[model samples]
Target: MHKQSVFSFISQLIWVYILLFSAVSFSQKLTSGFKHTNALINETSPYLLQHAHNLVNWQPWSEAAFEQAKSQNKLVIVSIGYSSCHWCHVMEEETFSQEDVAQVMNENFINIKVDREERPDVDQVYMTAVQLIQGRVGWPLNVIVLPNGKPLYGGTYQTKTDWIKLLNSLSKTYKEQPEKTTEFANRIAAGIQEKNEFGTEKGSVFFSKELLNTNITTLKENWDLTYGGLKGQQKFMLPANINFLLDYVILSNDAQAKKYIKLSLNNMALRGVYDHVEGGFFRYSVDTKWQLPHFEKMLYDNAQLLSVYANAYKVFKNPLYKERIEETYQFLNTIFKSKKR
Candidate 1:
């Protein structure tokens, strides 16, 4: 062979060696008895990076995933979770890591994992569905949907065996009971559509002065003065509602409403739900006393509550409320600034 032919042969040999070495390296890196064809390597998200080598042929939440599911007539299994959640990690190891479970999921459904912390809007919509379906919701929420993104069924985490059984059952149901599936999906879709369309009409209707006063009176009647927040075991620091109360107090010269607003803000700021160390509020309290929190501190919640505290300081001339507002701002600047992208 001439010099040029020898060089060409050498280049071809090098390419073949590179390909074979890469295949061996990949095989060695994968967990025993689990192999997948995912192309999500080097992704930055901690949650997505964790699943980069999962046994399931996972696709990112994309138009392609939905389109493929539609073309294949497959149900879309949307698994929503966050990185820090312990149960989310457990479910991944137990079910998503199993080769057989992954095979069933890949074959029968379009599995899509969503990082709830990354895309809260998606989480909120499906979480609402899960709540509607089961009358409660939690992390690692799972929803099964039709090709058009209409949720057909929803629940929380399942063990490997249970998930496999559920997948098998759902696959059979989808294949054999098409009309029944469509009927269930349509009912949910119509209900959700109507709820979304009508849910905000209350504010529109109660825009009048007398209606507003009446609503304020009704809300104050249920206020938990002893606990210093709204009346509930699951206490949410509803800043909007608080602001409405403040407005009512100012307009109607209601001393009780103003007193309730101050008490609620002070109690929430002093409670464990406020993240005294970190200086941002948790999602909400699980108990009536505002002691135990759900522990997911969201950006929007912190921003809104920060403003509320700042306004409270302006109204009451309280240094503690002003300090809380500054601390919340600092927390946002430190944590959220890093995660903005």
Candidate 2:
């Protein structure tokens, strides 16, 4: 539960994740022998380039691709993720590269592979829709959209069987029940537009002390008191949640909330979610205990987490929080230095 001690304890387990990361890169390289290639071959993005050899005819997000979809009267498959995404790599290997899977996708849909880092605009639109439809979202985000680009269905990381079934079913539905598909797409479009719209209502919203307390109380109800982080099978280290709670604790001197935040921070830092070897956090844990990491080190997540840890160091002055901030700083600097070359 301390500085170097946590690293020493978890060092052995860290190598297993390191090996998995290495193997994904290695397998991606081996695809050179596969005869199929797509327009993604010409893309500069490392994430898009990774899918260049897939049998699926992947286009970088463009007017031309959408134009083709309009011309062909086909739905669009907008699959978005970045290079460091583990599920994206898994979906590429297990679903995209397959001959049969690619056949269906190529025949039925205009498949657009988006590097989320490069196209946060596109990601935001469909990501909001996915959250609206599924009430949850994560990468390797796969959405089926109308040719004009309204989403019909959105989900993440489908197995090859499920991917095929989904494409076939959606394709069939679009062809047979055109009115129904359009109506559904219209609803999703409305929800996305409404969610993205800034509330322009004139009057300033009043926040009473009682109302603020009620809001905090409602939030606390969702907290996983035992292991920390939100109550769910999966645990994401959402810096915003911690950032808000940290500020509230400082202002209100809320002992109970402070204790819970400390517990959350401690568990997050010491658990498998934080890379013991690499000095950055993974995207999330597959389990609530923060022991089963999803194995993708997202820069945005790590950068925001750095702010959370540093601010916590200001308040708690915990040496462990300071250590995490230092480690994450070093990790980010190393990444930047490499990119500079």
| lDDT of the candidates, in the order given | 0.83, 0.91
User: How many backbone clashes can be found in candidate 1?
Assistant: 0
Candidate 1 per-residue C-alpha lDDT over 72-150 given as tens digits, one digit per residue, 9 for 90 to 100: 9999999888787766888889988888998998899998888887888888888878777788787799899988888
Give TM per candidate: 0.73, 0.86
What are the per-model C-alpha RMSD values against the true structure? Answer: 5.0, 14.8
Model 2 TM: 0.86
The per-candidate count of clashes, in order, stands at: 0, 0
The lowest-lDDT stretch of 10 consecutive residues in candidate 2 is 332-341
Rate residue 339 of model 2 by lDDT: 73
lDDT of 2 at 337: 49
Q: Report the C-alpha displacement of residue 82, candidate 2, in angstroms.
A: 1.3
